[model samples]
Target: MGKNLREPLLKLLIEQKEGYISGEEISQRLICSRTAIWKHINELRSEGYQIEAKPKAGYRLVYRPDRVAPEELIPHLSTTSIGRAVRYQRSVPSTQSLAHEWAKEGAQEGSLYLTEEQTAGRGRMGRIWHSPTHSGIWMSLILRPPIPLNQSPQLTLLTSVAITRALRKQTNLPIQIKWPNDLLIHGKKVCGILTELRGEQDQVHYVVQGIGINVNATESVWPEELRPIATSLAIEGGRTFSRPELIGAICGELETLYDGYLSYGFTPIRILWEEYAGMLGQEVTARTGQGSVKGIAKGLAETGALLLETHTGVQTIFSSDIEW
Candidate 1:
């Protein structure tokens, strides 16, 4: 669909929420032909929207798709464009890969790429992130920060804080962050964050922040390998949620925290993150590619690395798997 068509189409959908809208009325408001309106409606339906057409009643949205599109998401979103420009795919290899291409092609900061499923999604340390079709939020955000390269890890922490805060606001479920970048509920993983960066000496270009949240999948839906460790929002919350609302909350919170980080550094967000952290000050084991370390989870360093206090002394770990 053309760029000019989005606003009118969204307005019509919102207005029609109260009742059905005739295609003739929509065409008049949009100042376009009936054929154009029909085409746009088809486009919306193709994106999984459940728009119903009646013989005389015209079109009525009996059900809004669970997918997050700008037309459906923006009316409820509270961000200043963190998700303002959204690109949605029915299925893709990975949101991260798509976002990377957009960034390389000069996509604006805060532009978002979301997919219903990721055929080849990956998590930290190159682990596969199982993203089944229509069952999760597989998305990536493109960000350009002015911070030094050494401070990039703070951005990951900030993303986690945003997601955790958003989930808390949208649902009554108790959510917590597993140090560094995972969202957990009842000690099982519900979400993962992977941040990738592009840069030169001492300067950073863009950071693609990929987030995966298991939304509607059941235990049986997950691969057998993930059943023991993975969880879904519906499983913990006891009901389904609107994906658009959740996405809006995430992007809105992200934009708010990103602005704070840029102006005041990571101090404020760091404190908030520690409050929701899963195992801070508890005994845990961290498995890294190099080796494993068992220690007390002290907290985060100023730059956002995990602070592990070993028997010998304090050690700052940049990345690891947390075993509580």
Candidate 2:
């Protein structure tokens, strides 16, 4: 096909699965020819779709793969922009690096770069992120919000709320957020967010928010040292989940909250964040470049900074690592 037909065609087949959809009807609705539909059907089959075809009958959807490709995700997605355009690969050095490059190359806002594995995945503070193949979510989302450069970090906080709220609603899991961008289940780390921006002194061009989730990975996926503090959804939930479904749910929640954030301000998202926050009322240490501050994890400031209730008073920490 001249245009991208896989996404819409997949959606049509999924929605019209009450019986076999005739090829003539698909071509008419999608505004294509029967031959073109046949070509795309073959393409989907190559990608592990079990589409049944019969002469003079049509196509019937048998099964779909557990892949995170756009064809597999479009049926589950309901957002206007977020995850509308996706760049997928089996493995990469880093999806964050690709998002930066693609954004500079004029990729659209809300373009998502996804990978099953990342050989050199990066975390905050230049740490290496462990990315296992076919067992986790290693992806980055591109956003071009019309916010000031200093306010970009709020998107990171908004992302934690989006993912946590989505997972909680879908699975009834007790997922909670740590200050800034970490999500935990039962006090063990399940997801982490790393936000980077391309901006000038006053204006922001775009923001690349990378999110890593241990979705269906088992205990062996983590390194021996990480077992004490790290966890995956399968470990806590005792079952595996569809990665594409989780991604769609997160994107839907994100697009909603993101639209609201741009309209009003951070007030609404901040309120939701506090409700899902973890480690509050617990004594913790934040290590900053100048020094360290020990205080109780109270809440967040308006600028997305972690608020700490110390003995002296409430200390507002901007950039620091939390130690508990």
Stretches of candidate 1 exceeding 4 Å from the true structure: 1-7, 45-50, 54-57
What's model 1's overall lDDT?
0.87
TM-score of 2: 0.91
lDDT tens readout by residue for model 2, 79-121: 9999999999888999999999999999898899999899999
Model 1 lDDT per residue over 44-121, tens place: 777666788887788887666676656667777787769877888778999999999999999989999988889999
Model 1 reaches what TM-score against the true structure?
Answer: 0.94
TM-score of each: 0.94, 0.91
Report clashes for each candidate as comma-separated counts.
0, 0
Among the numbered candidates, top lDDT falls to 2
Between which residue pairs do clashes occur in model 1? Answer: none
Error of 2 at 183 (Å): 0.3
